[model samples]
Target: MLNDFLSHLFPRVVLRRNLAFSYTFCLGGLAFGAFLLLLLSGMLLLFYYQAAPDKAYASILFLESSVWGGGYLRSLHRLCSHTLLVLLMLHTLRVVLTGAYQKPRHLNWVIGCLLMLLCVFEAYTGYLLPMDQLALWATQTGMELLAIFPCGPLLRGILVPDGIGQSMSLLRFYALHIMLVPLSVMGLSFLHFYRIRKNKGVLPYL
Candidate 1:
């Protein structure tokens, strides 16, 4: 039904292509698959995570020391998140250097920029999850930096509300790490690649 409707609306857009034999899938396709793996592993980790003072740290310790295959899952999640950041940066630079950001592709570039920021935001939020003294102090420093701005007061209400306190801040970070940032990045990624295909552009290999 959806395909019929799309065909009816844009009869000549040529939605179907014989991509099964194409090598183009090897690059972008694998990156997207990795992103999905990262998301799933991240969600699994979230289920066992705690955000409190002792509970959060102890939970991670339990995962590392006792839970079966817990260390591997945690390592996979961390590694993929870091890998995604690197791949995304390389993809962005490829587009820029290839002049794909010029003219009609400018909006795609904007979407790519947002996606990059979302990756960074996801990492920043996830860093505080371990709840170690280092994570706590680092988060504190970040909050203080935010507090330096006039908008900081408003952000503080959202970041660490009075009612929920420190745990609330943890919840907010978790939401951003697992939900908000990932969703935004995924959406922008779709737009970015769709535009790339529409432009019939190949990024030059360095």
Candidate 2:
């Protein structure tokens, strides 16, 4: 009467033969590690980051200038975000080169692509949260470019229900940056890992 799939799904181990670092170069694991660091640093930042367009920049300035080690935390967050991007790209490339995307592994490949896209969007949405001039203008230009595409205006509306730098827009971005995107990434990561285990990815188990 219940799924219990997770119980059956987990508890399986990867083959020792597949454990060679050269097989994957650990890019995926490194990417996941960077993602975990981002989560930690980002959570700490939440206490200091103001979400409103009016107060956001000031709050970040205060965090950097006044809060002890706050600048370092922000820097670490930024570094991890960039590192995660690079690691994901390299990991995807390695997967393609290794033919991991063939046959039963294709679904995992799609999931991975979604993960990369989510990370990118998470960065894009977070960029405007501080409400700084450079980010504001850059994101505005990006949005404008997006509008040039078919259905782009509709997508933009969903992303920013009000004007750019407006309260609603900032809040929406804040929500997505802190909550929705992270949760979605974590959820998909679980599924991705499960699929890897199920498919005996990289090498056969047992």
Candidate 3:
């Protein structure tokens, strides 16, 4: 039954020891799995997180010291986030090396690029939520770097509104981290995978 279903979904050649399919280390699958893990761990963290600047740091401390498994959950989320970024870069490099960005798959390539940007932004916003001295300085540095661009001031204004470590800024970052960015990543990932399957899977060798 599984064989029949797979045969319908993939070409017979793909199932018959094709080097392209078999040789791939399934980096994309690994990245997607890491993303899902991050999502689960993040959701767990959300329950103990406070979005306001005043309470954010204290909330994290409480989670780490008081809540059961909180430290482990937070560590898992952090690890998965870093792993996802590395996996994404490797996956993109592999696609480029294989010339998988050619005509039929070009659109998916663009979508993948967008997904990468969103993932980075999501991580950045999450970085600010801890509200510790490190997070504060790191976020400030990021804002300063953004301000170097032509529209940096304007962009920073839109992002922080009042300033870093302020209530509005913390709330905005939290919302983008947990809501907007994740939703966009999910939508783009769906499109990216759909296009790959539609293009007959991972652009066979050469």
Give lDDT per model, in order.
0.72, 0.85, 0.85
What TM-score fits each model? 0.77, 0.89, 0.89
Worst 10 residues of 1 by lDDT: 1-10
Give lDDT for model 3: 0.85
RMSD of 1: 5.7
- Give the alpha carbon lDDT tens digit for every residue of 41-100 in model 2: 999999999888778999999999999999999999999999999999999998899888
Cα shift from native, residue 127, model 3 (Å): 0.5
Cα lDDT over the full model 1: 0.72
In candidate 2, how many Å is residue 62 off? 0.6
Q: Write the per-residue lDDT of candidate 1 for residues 127-198, one digit (tens) a residue.
A: 888988788777777777888899997886787774222667777887888788888877776666566556
Q: 1 or 3: which has the higher lDDT?
A: 3
Error of 1 at 103 (Å): 1.1
Q: Candidate 3: which stretches are off by over 4 Å?
A: 1-23
The per-prediction CA RMSD against the true structure, in angstroms, equals 5.7, 3.2, 4.2
